[model samples]
Target chain A: MHGLFKWSSKWWPGVIPLVIFWGIAAWTSTATVEGDLAARSNAALKDTVLDKRRISVDGRDVTFAANAFSEDGRVSAVASVEAVPGVRLVNDETRLVPEAKPFVWSAERDVVRVTLGGNSPLPSSRSKLMEAAKANLGGVEVVDQMGLARGAPLRFDSATALLLDQIGKLKDGRITLTDTKVNLSGMARELGGREAIAAALKNLPEGYSVAVNDIRAPPYVFQAYKDPVALTLTLTGYVPDNNVHAAVVAAAGRKFFSEKVVDNLKASIGAPSGFAAAVVPALGALSRLSTGTLVVSDREVKLSGDALHDAAANQIRGGLGRDFPQGWQYKAEISVKPASAPVDATVCQQLFAELLSKGRIRFESGRADIVSDSAGLLDRLIETAMRCPTVNIEIAGHTDGDGDEAANQTLSEKRAQAVMDYLVRAGLPASRFLPVGYGSTQPLAGNDTEDGKAQNRRIEFVVK
Target chain B: MAALATFFWGWLLTAALLGFGMGWIAVVHRAQAVSKAWMRWLALLAAALVAASFTRIVPGRFGYWLDLFLVMFALYLCGCAIGSWLRDWVVTRSTLAARAAKSAQNDNL
Candidate 1:
């Protein structure tokens, strides 16, 4: 036993060095092989959307772990790794990305920005969706909160692109895609925006359908403002078409009798039912006011201003709603204009003289139809007449001598009556004014030049 | 678990064999006996190591190494106890058999 121990001691020290040398050699070889396999595997999956890739090698065996977006992608990744030249056996720890049973995605819009949320099947698809949103929504801010996933329906990109187009038409709303079904709800940006979106949705990709579309159109509005100072009824906002627009202008001309109709209205497609019928009465209510604004939005008529008198205001408040079509609403915030201080007949005469000196009352050619150009002058005259409520006044009219004496006299009388009719319509008592005509005899200027003739044809207000 | 065993069996078996050889040599050669106080301290130390490993109070890759070392150590200690018991049984049986043989020779004489 002693001789055996003496012989073993000499070899034992050499064995330690040999064991360590082999250990290091084995470690270096394993590391080199693992690094090489990892590089090859990474190259195989570089173009694919595999996440959290890890590769380890024991001799030629490989353990590959990654998150793959689809079962096919997972299998393909494993197969590719196994196909690598040095790989003997593959330990597959590859799992599919989380599958959304009813894959839901949404784009929501608020006042400031739009947010896109839910899952996307591929990174490329996610990037495409982001680009589409930014391109379609103009300068609006876009936020992306989408996750990578599997089980997205076929043609998802096509369907999502179509829905994103609809989102651009919304002022504020949300559009959701669950699998191949779509749900949309929100207010449209313009009058015809809702219909436009509905029409566009018809072009959605095949196998896609609308589940719930509750998009609401903006109110179809028509607005008019009566400015007593400007003597203009400004027509603004939208009209149904050119015909309705012209009709509305004509109605304003007749009802507002004394104000120039400044037509600022645009022709548009979405006017509510009974829009023309509703607007005529709303303009009538506005015309009864000393100054007022009328807004016809959708099926509602809102009139606000001061009427010429307490009786007019009360009449407007009580009667405007009754004149509107059924299923339409009316709101009148009517108040009476303050009555002017009473003035004597001399002061009333001076006020009328002062107003007429600024601008003369005008008539249309040879007819007694009062041209709207004289509306500002006539409104001031009526306001002056209103100050002397208890006094009597005579409106005298004279024509140029270019025509026959009898015809001139008849034209002058009709013009004088037109002036009196305007004042009476302005809530003045008809008995307070007497209209008279002179047949080119009472001329303030000569009968020679055009300017002279224009001056000679005049209407004067005299207090008694 | 099977993969872990396949990876670590070499190290664990080597540790157990080393412990068994040491235990067997100590029992057979009548080496200096360890005191109860030393045994208690070693047990406490092992318990502390187990606690640290289980709670993962140690950090980084070193913590993993410590856990693996503790497992190997526990197996080695189990092997040492079994080896010591086996050696004692073998020694006791041989001594009894030798005594019986000597008595049988005396009776034959």
Candidate 2:
């Protein structure tokens, strides 16, 4: 026993340290193997388009826990984990959550063909939908890619047919049918296409409802062209009513001064919202260009012209966008008109009249603040005045008969001064110019009409 | 009875101390490289010795074998737990250091 104890004591010290070292080595190998397997599993899972939120690694084993939107996604995730290097086994804890989305079906029309996509409840319903789409599209290739599923609302056939009928009215747009909810988005084919579709929707079958009808009518296009050589302003396109028509013509007369106004504007039902408000201000800006076109389509105003001077071009480019009503967008293409040869007083006066007739100087309503659109016109006038350097010119401001005569005169005088200030800023000698305000006493047209009132408010240059 | 009770108490205390020692060794070797199979065998041997020491409190030949098996099994578990823990610590520290170095290099650039 004594000898055995001696042997044990001698051997135990060496054995303890060796054992500890071995234990540490074993642990390191296990950890490394597990970590490598986990990394490989993660990389494999990433290659698959499955949403793997958590991954755990055991020795030669990997477990994937993820949320999948479909059965295919769940299967793919499991297969991917199994394919990882050193993974002997895979534990798939993936759960499938079928996409909970509205039952949507759409038919999109392009120039050459119509493409149909989304879900249909029944096989018969799919064929019926395709037939209807083909019938309405007429001669356009119909590519059907709609899948069949259960759970369509009742009266699906009649509702789809009604929607198909309205598709004929659209030039191009998507129609979405979710149960009883119908949403239409596209441009209308005709002038009153929106109204026609709305009227047609009212006749839908019982229990059928319209959720969102966003069909836009064709653009209500209003165009005006100013010709300085002919002293004529030609107006075209649709206006809302007869009253607006007469007012627009009279306004043209007032801005053109002695020039003739040609009215060819037609009365139509579907002018864009805020058409009247935007058109008048736009016209005021147009009157200031030498040879310019003002085109108002829907809520978009496009003005392209040559300004009478450099400063006017800058002002018009910077300010016209601001002059538009809120939510209205304006694009200006203003370039400076080239300087004309220096001329005598009489010739300069004629040039001024011609330039002014091409466009009008605009002001803020009821204020002397010159509207930015008027900058180009003022610039041209300044250029003409500079040519007749020795001659004194008079800047006259006039107002319509809307307000008190004295107040109108004061407002006109301030506006005239505002013009003179702009000219001085353009390097013109203030001493060479006189500002005068003519109250509503001088009527270019009767103030009873909106167009006439627009005409009466004017700014003129007189070579003194 | 008194002897049996003493043996039981002593065995319990010894087992507890042994467990604590093994745990400490695991922690110490966490960042060290050692053979895993050798460590597992050593743990088995230690557990068997512990069980044999407690066999004095047991009466009968069956108790001896039971004590032997139990001690060996417990020691095997201890070895595995300690070894695994150490390796994990080493790997984790090295990975963190490498990441930090790479980040510093990027920052310098």
Candidate 3:
């Protein structure tokens, strides 16, 4: 065994060929895997679509061909295929089932389309079919060709398009008319039944006769009842640091304008712009909003940050004016709320606590320049101001005793004014601001330790 | 459970292989001069500490102090792998070393 081990060591050079062979084997195996990966990455799901016709896909290529017209019947399936493994491409297009085109009948509107049939209605049946189509399909239009009867001119009502929108609420599965004699085809529930259907049909003066078809029966006709005049709107926005949310709900409270400008718009004569300025238009929309409320949830949107905040505010104002270009079809609802508010007692308390934790605002020794690291905290405060345009802001600066009381007062006032300038540039009304300096007189914390001193040299928001 | 076990095995094998290979190189330094390689490994250890501590990979909640704990765990695994590999290398070289020693002795005698 020892001799063999020695021989194995001496003949180790002979194993060079074996090592080379193993290297080649490993390389070949690796190449095979690489090829598999390439194939998987490149492989595409072949599509063989049959949309009333035939479409075949091989990799990225598509081939479309149609077979003798109607033999495939109504091809209703919009089936798509995806690539599986191993096989590069696979598709089956040999056989396909024919679909049926069912006659669409409006049992309540008293209309039905014989789109695929070849038969004409009698003169008496002509008006009956037209009437059926009219009473059944709302504003969608009613056409009765009466089976290729040249120039029969299928009479239709354009109002059919807007009628069925209300029937969506009727719990009764069906509505039956027996007077002019017609059947309404829809699933109505028990909550609103035959009497409700009668009430709905009572107001239709649009040149048509409709009546109760039956009092009780399953698989019966149903009128899809619809409510004509009802709509809803929602409001969302940010508030300012010191702003308070008003609890007044601005709804369509007996306030309808006698003077309307360019449709769906009614405004007071007291608008800053003659009801047509960009601002006036937005204000006009805000007025038309039949209902509004203010809420302060964490709107984690970028509405409170940099250019994004301005962009968000612009989007809010701009969206109001154009929420409905076709005119406020239904009584419009609107809300113009703030981002955050310190003028709000509750929010101010929370914000104060937040600032307290961020190492109470301080200054650089005896200098009036604000410290650098606390810039982020100031940035957040500024962002809060940008959110609520409804409230006025006051920057009250304070200090701890070290210098002459008068000089301290002057420095505190300058510091307060500096913050105001930043806010004004950042887009706040200067008229809505004031700066006050409290020099060493009012300290929320003690003046003994560094921490207490830091707390004393601070600023806060007081609502105007 | 089986898939998870397989994943654990894969991680273990990769770590073991890395440690085994590095351990052999470290041991071979005992036979030859490889001060630069030793320093490079030492630098890698320091780098692992810094990367794990401040690089946000471990996260603030985990705290940076556990960096030494993780490093020690890694070193222990590496040492075991290196020790095992060294044992194997010695076993494999024993007969050859013996043969070389005998041939050289015969020539001298």
Candidate 4:
């Protein structure tokens, strides 16, 4: 041994080769073993739900560290690594994934995009939720900020899917799920969207319950505008049904006799109760104005327009709410139309002639009772007379010469007086109106034909 | 773990082999002077390795062993120096102790 220990020149060169060869052999062998063990162990844990996995092998012994969702999962993961071929031992550094006490998850929407945040039970669930958000909210950007955690409720994926469906209906709002309870708050995109979301929540999975739902629907609106220049009473916005829609249009036609009715109302759900009843009275007040707009939103009635005079404005302001049903509110922004530039008797007479030529005042046959159909024309006559405030006007009543002459004369006199009374009730002084009876004597057209008689039977306003 | 074992064994073998080789060259061949060019080349190689290790520019998982090899190399150089000095002392003492006896034996022969 001593002789062998004695350093020799021949042995020195041989040692270099020997050491080099041993180094190469040792490195290659150990690398091969470590690499083979790692690959097999990783493959064994491929199907397991492990997070932040780290595996180190030391001569067939494995040190595995990871977060597992449950105790069973942690044990199973370690065992799977140990069962890998050539793995002699497994040092489990694994622990159960942290429990989320409340396990809150949320999806929020703004104008531009929707954001999905909070914890998810699994990676698969996280991706699934992101995909589901994209699918539900079309054309809206979906952002994901979810992390993995344990202690999620049973059927969490199903509840989240259902909740995501409601997010699309919201214009802007947030939906939060803490454990098995759901809390939602936001504004709905449309009028009936609140009810829709409420109805949808009823279908949530069995274990889940709603803790708070504060969705608000947009206002239900019904609007009418009277454009005097256009001679149109335009009705636009929502009505309860086709019947109520037709009723509102018909009321507008009746109230605004001279103005053409342009119906543009849509029949939709979520109209306030008594919508038609409220709209009709509101339209009546609107028609009494020279030009007006009526808007009914939810249970509130808002009428805005210029009344023909101060008395009419006061009447509308005080009387509009009286006809509305219980629980209905009204706000009248009534202002009297400014009095027109005073006109001389000559211009007022021509204005009456032009107005009378357009529409006739019809009275009940043989009696002096005026028909309600002529109220619009009477209002125009009153409005004209108001312009000629200083001028006294003669309200002449003519007959068609069909009835008895004495009786026609008496009826004509009474009808003329009724016209004077109507003008007086419309805030015009009674002294400005002089009742006259022409009977059949001053007929403008021959009473031989029905059309001639119809033309001849008229009430003429001659400003004096 | 296996990589560590490999590195440890390689360090021991290299140091032992280099020390033995340096001792034998010093004693038997009577060569005390080292080539300056060889020393410069060794210094350049060691500097490059140190820079690589500090910058972590060495690639592959096995590159971690570079720092270990550097330390081993430093120890091997020290072992070589000590081995050569020890070898020289032993050789000088043995030669001096046997010189007179060998010379007289030659005269008799």
Which stretches of candidate 4 lie above 4 Å from their native place? A1-46, A51-65, A79-91, A101-103, A344-350, A353-379, A394-419, A435-464, B1-109
For each candidate, what TM-score against the reference?
0.63, 0.46, 0.23, 0.66
Report, for all candidates in order, the number of backbone clashes: 0, 11, 56, 0
Backbone clash pairs for candidate 4 read none
How does each model score on lDDT? 0.79, 0.71, 0.40, 0.79
lDDT of 4 at B53: 67
RMSD of each: 13.5, 26.0, 40.0, 11.2
Better of 2 and 4 by DockQ: 4
Ranking by lDDT: 4, 1, 2, 3
Model number with the top TM-score = 4
lDDT of 2 at A116: 78
Docking class of 4: incorrect
Off by over 4 Å in 2: A1-106, A115-157, A176-179, A190-192, A211-222, A227-242, A258-273, A297-300, A349-381, A393-427, A434-464, B1-109
Put down candidate 2 lDDT per residue, A279-337, tens digits, no spaces: 87677677767788999998899999887776666766786677566789989998867
lDDT of 3 by residue, A23-46 (tens): 443333333333442343233322
TM-score between model 3 and native: 0.23
DockQ of each: 0.02, 0.01, 0.01, 0.04
